[model samples]
Target: MNTNDSKLREQIAYFGRSMFERGLTAGSSGNISVRLDDGWLMTPTNCCLGNLDPADISRLTRSGVLVSGKAPSKEFFLHEAFLDRRPTDRAVVHLHSTYATAVSCLPDVDPRNVLPPLTPYSIMRFGKVALTPYHRPGDKRLGDEISIVAAEHRAVLLANHGPIVAAKDLESAVYAAEELEETAKLFLLLQGQRPRLLTPEQVAELERVFGEKEDDRAKTCC
Candidate 1:
């Protein structure tokens, strides 16, 4: 394999282990993908993120054709939809984060503002976390729902499912995904405690100064 493909494979393996170790995902429950110099590299269907083999990663053409390796994850439509809707997206990570999924189960959670402005890290890494409605795993309906919110959100929590995060690269995508879980964990900790949340003005200012450049964070590049 070419050096580029090898490196991308290593990245998938590395991030896969990190995600699995961090409890962001369990079993074979998460998927990841990154834009490549030629097209893209994605984790194979049913592959455990913690044990992915570089030679086993699914390769897709820029036009979405399956070029080599095993079949791509059935939920690939979700990734493709993000890239199609957001020209700047370079990587996609979908995970069944515990706290985020728990919050999604709340009947009153606002889809447009899933996470409160609890910390500057959340504001800078994720402008707004959209709460997408429930869809069966591998269902394309979820992709459609994400399309509607992609215009404004870099990360979204799938109701009764998980969170989907996008970034300029694999590391960034994973970082944002972790940030989502951590912030969600914080939200749960403050539940009913009415912990003071960042005001609209503060959130706005943080977004203005740090949001635009968040993709440049050391961990996020493709």
Candidate 2:
């Protein structure tokens, strides 16, 4: 591998292990991908994130041909949808994290924005998390749904599935996904009580100060 690819491989493995150890995902139920100049690097299908080998990461050409390492995750198209819709996003993380998936399975959550504005960090990192209706795992139609929502959202909840998040780099993506999980956990914990939420004015201010430029980029990319 070239120097950059070698470095990215190790990075993926390192973060994958962190996610597993922290219980963000378990039992091979998640995938991570990084967009590269030539193509992309992704976690192998059905491999435990806790024990990934840097050399076993999957490499795909820009045209989506697998050129090295293990088979790519079946959810590659889901990751592609985000990258395609957000040119600035260089990495994607999809995880069946516990609290986030619990939120996805809940009925009556706002489909357009599943996550409530419970924290400023969530708003700053995610803007709003669209919720896509359920599709069987590996369904191509899931990608179609994700592309439509991802055009306006950097993070989304897959109904009865989990959360998928994209960002400018792997670290940002990982942090955003972690934030999503934590916000979900908070939402569940405070379900019965009327917890204070960020007001619309506050949300708008955050969007204006932090999200406006990215929204413009998203529009241009779409």
> Can you give the TM-score per candidate against the true fold?
0.94, 0.94
What does the lDDT come to for candidate 1? 0.85
Write one digit per residue (lDDT tens) for candidate 2, span 1-222: 899999999999999999999999999899999999999999999999999999999999987799999999999999998899999889999999999999999999898988789987888777788999899999999999998888789999999999999998887788889989999999999999999999999999877877756544333322
Local accuracy by lDDT, each model: 0.85, 0.91
lDDT of 2 at 116: 85
Which parts of model 1 have CA positions greater than 4 angstroms off?
219-222
Which 10 residues in a row give candidate 2 its minimum summed lDDT?
A: 213-222
Residue runs of model 2 more than 4 Å from their true location after superposition: 212-222
Q: In candidate 2, list every pair of residues with a backbone clash.
A: none
Q: 1-222, model 1: which lDDT tens digit per residue?
A: 688888988999998998898888999888998887678888889888888888889999886688988888888889888877878878999998899889878888788987878987887776689988888887889889999998789898888988898888888788889888989999999887988888999988876776677645543332
After TM-score superposition, the amount by which residue 192's alpha carbon in candidate 1 deviates from its true location, in angstroms, is 0.8
